[model samples]
Target: MGSWERPYWESTVDSGVPRAAQRSGAYRRYLPDAIDGMALAIDGDLSRDVAVVERKLRALNGPGAEGLAGIARFLLRSEAIASSRIEGIAPSAQQVAIAELGQSESVRGVSEQAQLVANNMTIVREATTELVVADKVAVEDIVELHRSLLPNEPRHHELRTVQNWIGTSDWSPIDAAYVPPDPDRVVGLMTDLLRYLNGAAHAPLVQAAIVHAQFETIHPFTDGNGRVGRALIHTVLARRGLTEQAVLPVSLVLATLTDEYITGLDSYRHDAAPGSPPAGMAINAWLRTFVTAAEIAVEQSQQLVSAIEELRERWTERLAEYRMAAGLRAAPRADSAVARVLVHLPEAPVLTATTLARILDVSYPAASAALDELRQAGVLATKSIERGTTAFIAREVLDLVTWSERALASTRFDTRRAEPVRPVPARPQR
Candidate 1:
């Protein structure tokens, strides 16, 4: 292992029997030259391998891109759900949260975190749309994008604060690890990194890898660093217009490859030589691993999208057997309406007639009747309720929809000839 001078943050922690043993003596030197080279690799023209991947992605158009897009939406939705739940909000309440977010002309609420995520999704969509035609994007725009994602979250917004890292030392049981550079250094480091991100000397994917690693190493935020860091990947990719719709679920990939994900960051912190200079080899290894993960993520997402489309077709065929009112059919397509409602039920399984009426945009009687039909079909079950409020629960529809979407997105396809979905034939006006 390479040794280097310990950062001041590492020196300030108490070293008594209580905390001394927890400190890690392992320090890795970061070479600025390595960072520059890595930055070049990130901004450089697309490599043959990346171009091949891009062509493959483009060929995998239409259902393929749609599938990937669906997966991206779902994964992001899931992340928001998980993060909100972690912050003490119940999953079922997400509807209210989302509804409030959607209806409010202005973004303002106690659910600031959730709103930030929603905004991030919007920015990501816009950036992805623009990327399809652009060759490169400004790094300042990325910083602004990050700012937009968390403008209200104090510790996470645009500033870095003093914080302690945790690790285990040989003699110390467990203690604070290295203290990062002061705010000035952190900003300078990030500026350099962003310059690398915006430059044209490296592949976008490679840049994503190096930048992600460097951002984490910088530990720029006092909290929410991980989440924001992950968001940066989507920002860069979307800005670069790499994927169709910026549909990659990098977090999903990172979440699954938790071991390597953590190790990659650890390797950067523990393996590189101290004070010698940044080593391109160490960063490159991490980039290659990230690219591999991304490729896998894309394949998996494509498959998931294909599976979802197939399942949706099957569901449509099944639904066709019933001569339901056109108005009912007009209720937002199942995935957009019913599936969204059902996913929240793991926490609050009981949906009252009033709530159903609002959610489905039908009269209370109509909503209640629809519930009865669903219940009779064994797709929903009833639970105890008070007053005139009837509570109904969705069955396995949520799982079916979610998993099918994943399967379709993971399947690969030909991008060049693939076209966007043609407009559906219009039904006769009543």
Candidate 2:
């Protein structure tokens, strides 16, 4: 809403109009400076918020961070759920977990929304991992990410050639909420974006914010732009060495304030006249929102970490009681069945005796006994029993997951936590 102006060029278009040609105003070939032409000095509050978030993240990844990273799988799953929720696809944590581990029956009907959430889990994991070790983030890496998100779709790995717009069923930008610069500008703007992302032109947090907002404004892909834009948030932070092995579920917070989020993004589309003072106002607004959301994510993440640690201690106490009750003459094996199964729970919460048997490479009775012991310990509860298969729910973990996810949806948890039966596929032993 500030007096921001950006250059524009005239273009011919006719997709939504039944005419030979219609002149349209297209954003001119644009190249934003590292901070989107904004001075960092213009926003001290933003800088301070970024610092606090970074400090909390460092602490979150510190030594007290023990056992938290083990739940990185769950954190990534939470991120996927939230990212997908922003696009109006709400998949339960358990459903997404099942989908991620390549199991389907646990999720009934496998709604397109659930499937998309599952796909996002794959996209986020792949993008974050790739960016963590790469020196630079490439356009192809982004394109591949889009491809992975929208598998089997045309132009999945390519930028849009056809025109697209938001806020209307009709593809006319005339009444669109906002129009991106054009298909021809896709590569050029993307090139500019990658340059900013690669260089140390701004603080890592500021850079990450600019990268995400710019990508959203660019709307490069034919579809999956939102998911891809969100993925870039992780990529930028990872490439900048902000995060190591964890994916913060920041979108969950944004998802909770959908109206404010859209308004912030709309504010981010502001620009200034050519050769005028840099337009930092809108960038500042967006950065504040992003940073606050990230800070909340960190705080909530710490709570969950504590909850998991407490849960683990309770499991240990029960296991110790089991050891005593089992009349073991000496200490139970360090790699005892309960310990091994407990180690496996955070990775795959929903499992049956058979899957547990295979995953732990133990006999069915041994696996079943361990499961029964944990269930008796009140760690897992019976979810379902059908045709020789009995499924157990890691109820406590799901409670925390549902609390966070339902918070994102701005609603109470509707369904009970009764959910997965497979170990997540191993990453080639890496």
Candidate 3:
């Protein structure tokens, strides 16, 4: 059974702190049950719900899905962005893209927040790839993920040795909304959590929900717990082969349902015995929220796939018009640099000639020519990113990316139908 313990909180800071923050008191810290060997009883209706969403997930990764290669690339960014947004790290999709470019090259006007979100993308990608391939995850793997998420913050890279709380004064755990198990219990709890992850006792979605909820409850790291917990969602799905090529972007749905998300986590933290009715109900409720988010993610992904395909078709028409106006006799060859660049636009919506060459495995001159040809066709816009480097922007693709962000923020998944529940990027200028 999981229960809370009343622990004495000793304040270590006093300068400029409020009296309440500087005072010592006893705080309730939750200690969750070890999930290893726990038998979960999911009823028939909820089982059916899980099956439906799993089917949808498999379909989204199906062979016939359009622009999946491109969708896979950008959807990773979307997932990272939404996950960060849930932590109040909001950055426009454009700013994030620029920060990504800034990672390797000089780009002016990138915000620190955007850079942090960009780092988050790397962490999310690593979670899906590295953790998925590991034969068995260790506690160190989770710590490494947190380290990657906060690369510059050396103090937070390891499991916290001191007490931490979710909401309240930062100086102490006094009157905190949620305090995790004491630091000494973190390593043991995490070991049990990984034991459950290494085994496949439940449905993929069910296991993912339990793993994520358990991780958040444990709150092992001093910082980046929410982001790491969300990333674990991907690790579970990918290791189970539910999402092979593309991310599910469930965080996009969760960001819209922030209140419900918190409530679900709270319910998962209930202090009932593991096999008791209240415990079953609490886990079931959290599973329903997760399943619904997965379903919505699949639906929104289909819409994005179709939208990207349509945009590609429009690009073809523009290229054809440009070719005719320039008196060119034949379309670009399928294996030509121009065609290859066009196909890769969604994956690399903004790229410099140097980077494009590396991405396409072509010569620098060839990549530059392909970019220039696309720019002439008005399929791409060129921006001077540095003193000598020029970047090609697939504005149409980025517009759709921005629109998808706005749509995800909206309750109806369509901005015109419902206003966004949270702030989103402004519409791209024509």
Better of 2 and 3 by TM-score: 3
Which 10-residue span in candidate 1 carries the lowest summed lDDT?
419-428
TM-score of each: 0.60, 0.75, 0.87
> Rank order by TM-score, top first?
3, 2, 1
| Pairs that collide, model 2 | 5-271, 5-272, 350-420
- C-alpha lDDT of all candidate models, in order: 0.51, 0.65, 0.81
lDDT tens digits by residue: candidate 3, 1-430: 6787888877777779888888988888899888998877887899998998898888877642536545445545644555454455467666677788887778887787777778778666766589999999999998888777666668888888977898988888878889999899988999999999999989999999999999999998888788788788888998998888777778778879888898888888767545554777778888888888888888888788778778888888989899889998447889889988887787778888888888889999999999999999999988787788888888887778778778888888888999888877777787
Task: State which candidate, 1 or 3, has the greater lDDT.
Answer: 3
Q: What pairs collide in candidate 3?
A: none
Tens-digit per-residue lDDT, 54-131, candidate 1: 555555555445534533564465444433333543232233334333433232233555554454555544543553
Candidate 1 yields a Cα-based lDDT of: 0.51
Error of 1 at 417 (Å): 35
The Cα error of candidate 1 at residue 342, in Å, is: 17
Candidate 1 regions exceeding 4 Å error are: 1-4, 8-52, 59-61, 81-157, 161-163, 166-182, 267-278, 323-397, 400-430
* Candidate 3 structure, TM-score to reference: 0.87
